[model samples]
Target: MMLDSETTKTYTRPISKAWWLRDRGHFNRRYFMFLLRELTSVFVALYVVLFIYEIFLLTKGPDAHTAFRESLSAGPWIAFHIIALLFALYHSYTWLGLTTKMQAAGRGLVKIGTKTLPPILIALGSYGAWIIATCIIAYLFLTL
Candidate 1:
């Protein structure tokens, strides 16, 4: 059975454009961090775009690629890279920790046999794997 539209009216609360910024008490450190985490994606996307552009520049011959390389070697470019690296690191850290949060939420993302693994263990495993991979890559890069 369908209810009458007049009798079953729903109220939609009016929210400000800067709702996130408006609520100082409700939007605490966690909310700010969440926003920061989201902002990290912009830097990551920018770096990916730059990398693709560099690859495209390579196809345009040595002179174009050399100019791009020279521009990247400048102070401002170096600072941008450093900032991007920090944001990228933060993004990666938060991403890897998400598994632990999910597991801890009792969703059973990490389970062994009938028993569910602890959140800390899940976090450790992810971070450990990341460290191992980084070490291997670093080793290869240094050697080759």
Candidate 2:
């Protein structure tokens, strides 16, 4: 059973049983930066909500603040931070990559801004952040 090329749909290639065997490296950007951006957005939203809830509890009374702070000492606390760390890293990478794209500028549309920062420099910053984050995570694993 195979998905007919005419009936199947993908930006670069049709869905098929042989999809896994297909050279996906050549696949288009349809499944792309938007996903990473959305994911990071979701994580940021969750963080805001969680912190807001904590603030609410703090305003309610001292016991609530104690419970909220105590929650951070447990396993779930570590998991939350780990997920946040991954989302944050992806967000940074995507932002830096997209930023380097040349943009047309000026009200007359006669000029172009060729990019203030070099792509390699932005890439280095992104990679540098990843290395620093990985080291921190490794340290946490060893000590915690």
Candidate 3:
């Protein structure tokens, strides 16, 4: 007797345990960059957790907080922060590029007066705002 198509079991190929690293040697620059971009989240999450822990230490008193800060000044932690900063900047740049692409793709949805705004202009505006905000925060942090 022939089984109906609906009753047939379909088999899927099993994925290799090391599938993600299978072609590490042959990946193009874009592929590597994409992987690095994803890796940035781990650093970002780590930094956030460290920041929260520092805040918690603050409640324990000045000595605890000072000790924590001193610990972070060690060589390994300094290197980690430097690496994390680089990755964070890379991630931010990629995100901004994506935002530009999305805005360009949707330009027709929002017209300004007689024309759509340029994508580069939008990107520059975003970068400009980021710079301004950073400067303001830095100034406040330094002065107050």
- Overall local distance difference test of candidate 1: 0.88
**Each candidate's TM vs. the true structure?**
0.82, 0.51, 0.78
Q: What clash count does candidate 2 reach?
A: 0
* Most TM-score-accurate candidate: 1
Looking at model 1, report the run of 10 residues with the lowest lDDT sum: 19-28
What's the true lDDT of residue 84 in model 2? 90
Flag regions of model 1 displaced more than 4 Å.
1-8, 24-27
What lDDT tens digits, residue by residue, belong to model 2 across residues 37-68?
77798888888888899899989899889988
CA lDDT, candidate 3, residue 118: 80
Residues 1-144, model 3: lDDT tens digits: 444558677654554454444444443666556778899999899999999999999899999999999999999999999999999888888876776777789553335897977888878977877788889999999999
lDDT of 3 at 144: 100
Which ranges in model 3 have alpha carbons more than 4 Å from their true place? 1-25, 106-110
> Which lDDT values do the candidates have, in the order given?
0.88, 0.68, 0.80
User: Per-residue error at 130 for model 3, in Å?
Assistant: 1.2
lDDT of 1 by residue, 91-115 (tens): 9899998898999996568678888
